[model samples]
Target: MTKGYIHIYTGDGKGKTTAAIGLAIRAVGAGKKVCILQFMKSLAYSEQKILQSIPGITLITLGKPYFIAKEGMLTDEQRKTWGNHIRIYPAGHPPKDYREMTLKGIEQAIDAVSKNYDMVILDEYNMARWYDLATEEETEKILKARRPEVELIFTGRNAPKEILDAADLITEMKKIRHYYDKGVPVRTGIEN
Candidate 1:
């Protein structure tokens, strides 16, 4: 209907990626083409397997699962936990490869959109921009150039104002409270 559109999920809270994945699942159920590109997250959760089981849905994970911490932002325990999440590839260091793969994934997603996909999810893409792995300018350009017939969704914290302005629908997950703040670690099937 109306050649599809754009949906943005942002703000400081959980459920951004979960919401996007829910939409992806819905689109697939309705027999629509769907693709999800998750940046900064490696495939380690049950959702990866479940998503793979869905027909007409494709998922691409870009980058190693290293934690994004500013200097002195995390304690040693947090650093260790993050370290355990790091993903290493067989071909030496993976940061460069992650960048290249991400770019390629974006290009491929654009192509899929142009080819008449129903929905595309750029999961945690804002984090990529926030971390300087992807530029806001480039993301803006891509959004501007997206096919009118494609419905796109972007999920992550700190989405730029420009993106919010351009989006047809925006959902912000404001953090009221979370278990993590109560010393609860992210668990599989819940926060992964």
Candidate 2:
């Protein structure tokens, strides 16, 4: 292709990452190289097992093993149930180590954009910025480094205004309803 544009998949609903993955698959099918950098996520997701083996695709996950929630985002009962599997922190004070790890991941993304990758997906990047794991200025680095032929996709909820403005296309998945609210857990290969 001669030119590629930026795309953002945001909002509280699901399918943001799914859309990005679909695009990656399409790109690969067309003989294009793809790199997916998942921020604030670990390697436990089932998709990673297959994505890692896909030719012409590079998958990198940057996150701790445990989930993280901003203080007050989770109910007391929820916290109790999660126990040591989740970490809750006060607003504006996310874990320093996590933030540092993401910053390095941002650098890797920037480098990937500079390389020959035809498409780059920054999964959960919106949440990373929302939770202060990454800053808009750091995001700017990847934007600035993007080649004209490199497509960039950012996925996750609560995309900041700056990100929305910078995107060539934006798709917000508004949740009309979800089974999770009805006490369903995230099923593997679907919501995980």
Highest-scoring model, lDDT: 2
Residue-wise lDDT of candidate 1 within 144-170, one digit each (tens)? 667887889989998877778879999
Which candidate ranks first by TM-score, i.e. highest? 2
In angstroms, give how far residue 102 of model 2 lies from its true place.
0.1
Task: Give me the displacement of residue 59 in model 1, in angstroms.
Answer: 1.2
Candidate 1 residues lying further than 4 Å off, grouped into runs, are: 70-77, 80-95
Per-residue lDDT of candidate 2, residues 16-92 (tens digit):
99999999999999999999999988988988999999999999999999888998888889999899998888887
- How far in Å is the alpha carbon of 109 misplaced in model 2? 0.8
Stretches of candidate 2 exceeding 4 Å from the true structure: none
Judged by lDDT against the true structure, how good is candidate 1? 0.77
